[model samples]
Target: MTTTSVGAPKPTRHTADSEGPRRSVRRRSLGDLRVALIFVAPALLGFVLFYLVPTIRGIYLSFTDYSILGNPIWVGVKNYVKIFQDKLFWNAMGVTLEYVLLNIAFQTVIAVGLALLMYHVAKSTLIRGILLMPYLVANVIVALLWFWMLDYQIGIVNQVLQWMGMPRVAFFGNEFWAIPTVAFVNVWRHMGYTALLIFAGLQAIPGHLYEVANLDGASRWQTFWKITMPLLRPVLLLVMVVTITGSFQIFDTVAVTTQGGPINASRVIQYYIYERAFSQQDFGYGSALSVILFVILAVVAFLQMKFLRGNENDLD
Candidate 1:
């Protein structure tokens, strides 16, 4: 052993030198991180200033007694209590739920059908673009346009009905017809975009899968059930979430078209919130209502997620 052998490995000067560069690289990385944070600072600031702060403030306001023009008085859960006891609030809740359920049902069936139809159509882009024109139109404008078209007497639909010897339907004027008409208008405005989303999903299915299905002598319905639906799950989930979220937040259409109707038939929760907040200027109560809305939406979204990915045999 030349008197230099040792049982343990000895540290080398070269190893020490190598560590210097590693330290230098680490310092540079830290510098780069600081620069990256600096670049992101404005967006962080904007989010904190605009969204986070307001959300926190709104949550606090929900427990208070403050009209928009008045100073906030901490009244505990009085606002929530009031809203819970309000019959109109409960009615709005029921109406809103009905709209969401119906909207999602019609959208799911129609949009999926449209997607499947367009998947096979020639010159699809042109057709899809034309369809999307309705979605591109502003909600308020669409509602107003539909309002005119569905009017009791002078509107085109009624005019045509009159000419065809059918009774003029009171689309927005009747309690029973009011909500359905608004919901229909919503679907008409948004169906194209929903179909586009589903179409994209359809396009993503591997062509080889379909070829294999054909080689297996699979019927078209068989192919659809086994291949198409399973593959479209993710996009379907996304569409469900989007539609549900939008349905809960529906206000502009109800406002512009029905104004909560001749009998509050079209008064969704959002419309109810608007009545409390802006119309009556009870900001605190409105905030409480919003908080309830938030909880309802959160629960609904959680359930949707659970339903989408929860099953033990599921293949997400």
Candidate 2:
């Protein structure tokens, strides 16, 4: 209700002008959200249908007796109670632990050493490609290849051992050597990939720190201990979590090479679960075993992250 002279400026609807851009911005935001959802829909759907649904179904099946031939009968905690009294379960657990320890110990140390060598000596793409080739091969193929190569009768390894004046040892046949031989095969297959992971971590470390250490007259060993190890802890934590979990779920190599032979020598927990669920048609017991493994892995991961301070770095 204000009058304006001809020479004076005209009043503009600032509120209306502001609202036009606001509405445009809101429309743009909604359009972007739609695009994002469209992109994410496939993976989200996969997670819900495959992972989430199977996990829930498995948990429920753990409480019921589902033999696939008949309807599931709810047995409450009976499967779990049976698992507690199962000596085979305990033996599988112990054997799996031995495999995990052997695999992790050799794999981590060798991977770190290879990473260091790659970082310092040969940082070539060709070398890295050759190292990664074993990992690219299928697990079954790798296991079978190693199985034949380590065969006691006419295998290359045994031939070399005999040439060296040592008796040909049963790499996969004997109970004492079965688990270790299986562990070694997996270690050889996976170390290259693990080395690349550690190599990436090494690349992240600041080079200037090493230079400063050199200026301070620090020995190579001292620099590695003080600088490299501290900064590398986070990456090591990640490597440990991944490798240890995968090691616990060892089945393919054992299935191919040993088949849990020589009196359950290499029967890992996963193999045991597979036998119960598939061979014996005891889904409830298998599911209960799977749940126990899940709990163990969860606790182990939590402990590793907590103790290693995985989220925190000493780069400061």
Candidate 3:
């Protein structure tokens, strides 16, 4: 009986080597995660402190009877009820909707048209630069310039009307003209930015598509309608959504030009909220109105995303 003591099988060198690399990879992955967290910490902290905390506090304050000077007292939905009953609130809502629709329609049309023009004049750097100049000017400066241009007595617009043998109209004074005048100014101030965005989308589209369309003997209008418009749908949708939200939040123009005047014709939801919070010192009501605005914006953005998502798939 030659019983040779069997030595324990030596651990496989290859297995040991594989274990080392796996351990190294795991360690590297953990290290990378830690670094990413470190880089994101500041932004996370700022978002929580500035946006999340304020949003939560505002929502809480909306259901209370709070003023600037006093502690918030629970009041259930009285603020919301009052908002529903207030005639001014309804009027402001109607004005806000009108402004939103007008701005969206006009801005989309002008911006898309300008973007199409810019696409064609892509070789002209000077033209593109000139087109973009208005977007760079400060809002206040633009408002002031327009103020001078639309002044009732000394304005260039009225002067031009007189020169053209038309009656000198009060652009910002008359109730009928006030809202439209402000809308025009808003359009002028923002159209360049919107057009630039759409232009970027147009440039991203492959030039080969246009070449193919031309080879197929497609006319310029046909090519634009079938190719450019469809390809730029995402950008157009984004611009429309942003314009709608901004229109709903119309304030600076109304403040600087009309002051929500000519019988509050230009008083949008934002102006109403400002008055409730600052002028009347009713913080709770203002917060309630803000919450309502937030809800509307959220719904609009969601619907826009849903609509655009379908188009995106089609494009893909």
Candidate 4:
């Protein structure tokens, strides 16, 4: 018999199985990633075309003397300098700050209060659905509705006051009350949404934690302070950020209700920006103001994130 080498390398069955499956898995993973990218492409394109490009262009235009009819001339900070020198800009800044602070304070308080109430209620689903009705209404519709209700004469608010033997208050006509009145309307429109967010956060807390707290003889107030509040800090910070930014950008309500009238008392930064860009046709100044608002919001958001994250790390 011819002595064929019995030890001549037999095909490694394990190697074939392992290598084939590994290649197949890698190809499958790559295909999945490709599919995911394809799904997200439209959204990415839309964001770039609509938001990102316009934002970059706005920043670039802020440094130039660009208007509707003329070519942009390089002005280098002239627009920003003008903004600093403009007394109206400072006044608008003040009004914006006042609006932001008051709205944040009242909205946070009322939203948190409502969340707490809903948390303890027997019919939470019904309460939440009722509360969210205002949020579902369009902002323009809310503004129009409130505009009628707040009308100085023949409005529901004034009628209610007169019926209750109180003075018919001039809400929009007076400079002192215009900002507050607009802010109050904003709170009314947004409070339900904020409360719903807080309520969701509250509901997400595990019932076992509360049970353990109760076993430890903790009262509701004690449990809230020691457990609920600490756990809810992240959501509260988010609410603060949203409320602050939204309040600072208040425009529609001011436009519909006050139109920056009564000596520009209700003129927040956004309305000022709108007036400069569209009404007055000063795009450079408006772009500069827009940049300023962006910077202010960015700084506040950064600080808030930093502070909150520091607290979170400590807790962890």
Steric clash pairs (candidate 3): none
Tell me the whole-model lDDT of each prediction, alpha carbons only. Answer: 0.85, 0.89, 0.82, 0.84
Cα shift from native, residue 202, model 4 (Å): 0.7
- Once fitted onto the true fold, the runs of candidate 1 whose alpha carbons sit more than 4 angstroms away are 1-22, 310-316
* Highest-TM-score candidate: 2
Backbone N/Cα/C clashes per model:
0, 0, 0, 0
Winner on TM-score between 2 and 3 is: 2
lDDT of 3 by residue, 10-128 (tens): 22333445666666655665565556556766876787799889999999999998887989999999999999999999999988888887877898899888888888855598988
- Candidate 3: C-alpha lDDT: 0.82
Identify the leading candidate in terms of lDDT.
2
TM-score of each: 0.88, 0.90, 0.88, 0.87
lDDT of 4 by residue, 213-308 (tens): 999999989999998887888888888887887788999988887889888898889999999999988898899999999999999988988978
Per-residue lDDT of model 2, residues 11-36, tens digit only: 12333355566666565655655665
Q: Write the per-residue lDDT of candidate 1 for residues 1-316, one digit (tens) a residue.
A: 2122221123333354566666665656556556656676787778779977888899999998888787999999898888879999999999998898888899889999988888987445788799789999999999999999999977999999999999999999998888888889999989989999999989888899999999999999999999999988888888898799889999999988778877879889999899888999888999999999999888988898887862332233
Off by over 4 Å in 3: 1-26, 310-315
Residue 303 Cα positional deviation in candidate 4, in Å, after optimal superposition: 0.9
lDDT for position 63 in model 1: 95
Indicate the TM-score of model 3: 0.88
